[model samples]
Target: MKVLALEGQKHIKSFIDFPHDLYRNDPNYVPELYIAQHDLLTPGKHPFHDHSKVQLFLAYDDQNKVCGRIAAILNNNHNAFNNTTDGFFGFFECINDQKVATALLNQAELWLKKQGITTIIGPANFSTNETVGLLIDGYDSPPVVMMPYNYSYYLQLIENAGYAKKTDLLAYDVPYDTHNDRSVRLLGALQARLKRSNIIIRKVNMKDFKNEAAKLRDVYNQAWDRNLGFVPMTEKEFDYLAKDLKMIVNPEFCLVAEQGDKFIGFALGIPDINQVLRKVKRGRLLPFGIFKLLFGLKKVDWLRVMALGVLTEYRKLGIEACLYGLIIQNAISNNIKGAECSWMLEDNYMMNNAIEAINGKIYKKYRLLEKAL
Candidate 1:
């Protein structure tokens, strides 16, 4: 068995293709867009490379068959913000072999050690800002957009590799049709109260999305300041992400809170494009794949509430509840089947209770594992 640094196009393609074969029999596995992954891993294309660095590695067995993959990451912002020398491991996927998993993780640790890092933490697909964590719970269904899905054996493999739980991220499931929605019952009252305070909630104006996103970026930085491992995104990074999201963002589900032109808070619920991508074999979008993604948008039945927050100073003023209510209302109106309010820190009681008040069940759990170097 051997571990190889993924550098050349051949190695890079192998890294991306390994998972497709790994999860082939897993009914819930959704193949992510190949082109998007390519761009993200490519330094000049993904903005994360501008401020940080990542090195992809692939593990191969005696017969030269790919067995596992990992990305050893040095998030400069994560260290500077937390004031700790912590490197990260992400993009991990492997066969159910302990040796393969161990080799993959050991390489990541050694790479991080070389970067002067004292601890290795992750499955952060580079950082907390992207697809982070190993899906340790809720394997009954496919994951929503931007979320991860892995087999139960992964937990044992990671633990066997000596990675301990650092923290768990939560994902709430709000079934639009079946669940009793307390948010809907209280939404009228909540909106009335917010109105009294001169606060207005409205759909994002696509005509002015560029300017609106700019303001919301500031709110995002401050709103999540207290979350574990969060680092404010650079301007270029935020803009790059905004542009990608805008391509799939439904204006009705992209909402904002304002008081006299000031963007104080926002909530983004994007259609679960995975419903379409599940049919896009190999995650390719050309030929028939593009048609599946295009015509399949209308049939997407769920929305992934990827983000929702208010500035710290303005929090707990019913703003969080109001945003959630609006998201639910819009989702129901659009006939969406469900909404996933996800990747929430497990310890955030205020937000957790708010979601509970709206009948959002804790349906999935993801964990970030760590090992002291």
Candidate 2:
């Protein structure tokens, strides 16, 4: 086998298309949109490229067939914040071969070492801001819109390559039909209490998206700062992300909590666009792809509660429950069969308990791996 760096359009196309063949027989596998992958890999188009460098490599068999691929990334922002040199491996795909997996990991490790990196962690497609983690469990169902999925054997390949578990990211499923009645009952009461305190939960104003995103950014940084591996996004990055998500943000499900004029908490739900993207075939959006995406939106059966947070001082005030309840209520009204409130830290008891209170089941598991280089 020979390892090759992705240097041209052919290699790039191979890098993106390898997974289609790998998971062709897996019923739950979803093909990510090709154009989105291209944009993320391209330097100037993604904010990650602004502060980090990445090198992608593809493994080829003797006949020159693409058998595996991996990306070695040097996240300057992570290193700068933690004061340690850590590299990352992402956008990884491989056939079920230990040798190929080991070779790909070794190549990534060597590349990071040359860049003075001492530790490596990931499966993060780019960063925590994007899709991250290896799907170790829940292969019975297709992933939600932006979640990751991989063959179960990938876990063994990774462990055999000397990587150890760094953390587990949990994904919960909340069925609109069967979730806890208590949460449903308390929701109105909580909203009433919040109203008494001048904390009103309302839909996001698309007309004021810029200003609304700015306010949420402040709350996001403050609320999530204490969580494990949390990093504050720069204003530019936040705005960039907000612009992309706005296209899918449903006003009823994307809500904000305010105390008079202060933005205290928020919840964001997005249609599981992956359902449409899976049919986009290599992520292209030309010819019929764009039509499929646009027309498929109303048919999506699931929603992903991608973001829910309450400011630190606002904790214990039931704002978190209010945000969740509102999102759930909206999902039910829209006929969304189920929703995923996911990628939660394993130790986040507060959020987990709130989710459990609403009958969200921990259905999927993703792991972050780390190793000394």
Candidate 3:
């Protein structure tokens, strides 16, 4: 097998399309949106490129068929914010061939080494702010919206390449019917208790989304500061992401806690659009695919509680529980069947215990891997 650093439109398109063929027979494989992938990979299209660099590689067999792909990424903001010289590898895919997997990994390592990186970690498309981690456990079900999915053998391939687990991220399954309603039942009391301290919980106002997003960004940067691989997003990056999320963000599912105009915490849940995207053949969104996505929105029964956090100074005041409680209540009222509160750090006992208190079960585990360059 030969590995080549991908360049130009044709190669990038091939990189985005390879997974379609590789998982053609897999029932659970959901093709990511083609346009979304294109903008992400193209340098000028995504805000990530303004502060980082990514090099895509493709592995080809003797007959010139693509067998694997990987991306070597240098995230300047992560290093600057965390004070570590770490690079990242993401957008990785390969057949079950050791040769192809190793070749792709070696290429990424070599590229990172040349950039003066001492250690490399990922499956992070850019940073922890985006989709990161490998689907190390729970391969039986398709990943929720914005989550990663891969063949089970990927664990062996990555481990054999001399990479070891850096950390495990947890995904909890909370079915509406089965989840403990204690949190929701006590939500009113909790909100009243918080109100005593001048904190109020309410749905995000889409009419004033721009200004609201700005305030939330401040809390996001502070609340997630201590998380592994956390990197504060620049204004442009946050706005770029907010614009995309605005397309599917439900007002009721996005809640914010405020201390009389000072935002202190927030929780955001998005409809599982994968329910529609799964049927969008090859991830295309033109012609018929657009119609399917538009009409299929209301039929989606699942939600992904992608973000929930409170500023450190305001923790333990029952704000966290209230945020979760409100989201759960909204989910039930909307007729949503279930929700996945995901990508949580395994050792986050506080958050984990809170989810467990609500009867959330650990249904999936994803991992980040690292190797010294």
Candidate 4:
């Protein structure tokens, strides 16, 4: 077997298609959108490339058949924020072979080491802010919007590759029947009490979205500053992401918490686009996929509560619960059956408890792995 740097459009196409080809028989595997993936991997299309370097690699067997692929990434922003020379490996997919898995990892490590990184961690497509982690549990169902699903054996392959568990990301399932108006009933008192402090929750104003997003960006950076592997996204990075999200963002589910005119915190939940994307074969959204995606929004019954946070000083003021409760309220109002508030840090007891308070069941687990270079 041999590994080669992805050097051409042909190789890039192969890199993107490998997973779709490999997961052909896996019902739970959802092919990510081709355009999104393409733009993400291309330097000029992603803000991450502005402050980092990423190299793609593909493995071939003796027959020259593609056996695996991985991305070696040196995120200068991450290193600068943490004050450590750490690297990341993402976009990993391999057949059930230890040699393939180990080889793909070694190639990434070699590249990272050459760039002065001493530690490697991931499964992050690029970073913790994006799709990251290997699904270690809950393979019975397809992933929700923005979540990832992988072969069940991937856990063993990554472990065999000598990567130890650095952290686990948790996913919870809130049953539709049970989620309706529950948060409102449970947290009404808390909401009223907090109202005395001049905090109010309102739908994100689409008319002022750009400015609102900027404020939320500040809160986002401050809210997760101490998280493991946390790195503040550049304004360009946040704006880039916000642009994509705005296309599908529902103001009702995109909420903000404010005091007078000052933005204090926010939470955003998007309709599970996967509900429609699931029918878009190979993640192609052009020919008929766009129609399915556009017309299928009304059929989307689940909301992926993607982000929820309160300023550090605002914690314990019930703002988190308020934001969560309001999202649940909107879900209930819209006839949306359920919501998944997830990819939460496993060690975040406070946030975990908050989710659990709303009857969010821990239904899936994803792990972020690490290795010393």
Top lDDT hit: 3
Lowest-sum lDDT 10-residue window in model 3: 5-14
Tell me the spans in candidate 3 whose CA falls farther than 4 Å from its real position: none
lDDT of 2 by residue, 1-373 (tens): 9888776455788898899988888777888878778877887887877888999999999998999999998888777766778889998899889999999999999999999999999898777767899999898988998889999999999999999999999999998889886766788899899898888999999999999999999988888877755667878779888988999988988999999889998988899988887787656788889999999998998999988999888899988887887777778889999899988999999999899888899999999999998
Candidate 2 clashing pairs, residues 3+ apart or interchain: 33-283, 34-282, 34-283
What candidate 4 gets wrong by more than 4 Å, as runs, is 8-10, 180-182, 186-188
lDDT of 3 at 141: 88
lDDT of 3 by residue, 43-151 (tens): 8889999989999999999999999999999999999998999999999999999999999999999999999999999889888888899997898988889999999
Return whichever of 2 and 4 wins on TM-score: 4
lDDT string, candidate 4, 169-276, tens digits: 999898768754556876678778878999888899999989999999998999989899999989999999999999989998998999998888999999998888
lDDT of each: 0.89, 0.87, 0.93, 0.90
Candidate 2 regions exceeding 4 Å error are 8-10
Cα RMSDs of all predictions?
Answer: 1.2, 1.5, 0.7, 1.3
Residue 208 CA error for candidate 1 (Å)? 0.6
By TM-score, how accurate is candidate 3? 0.99
Which residue ranges in model 1 land beyond 4 Å of their true spot? 8-10
lDDT of 3: 0.93
Backbone collisions counted per model: 0, 3, 0, 0
lDDT of 2 at 26: 77
Indicate the TM-score of model 4.
0.97
Better of 2 and 4 by lDDT: 4
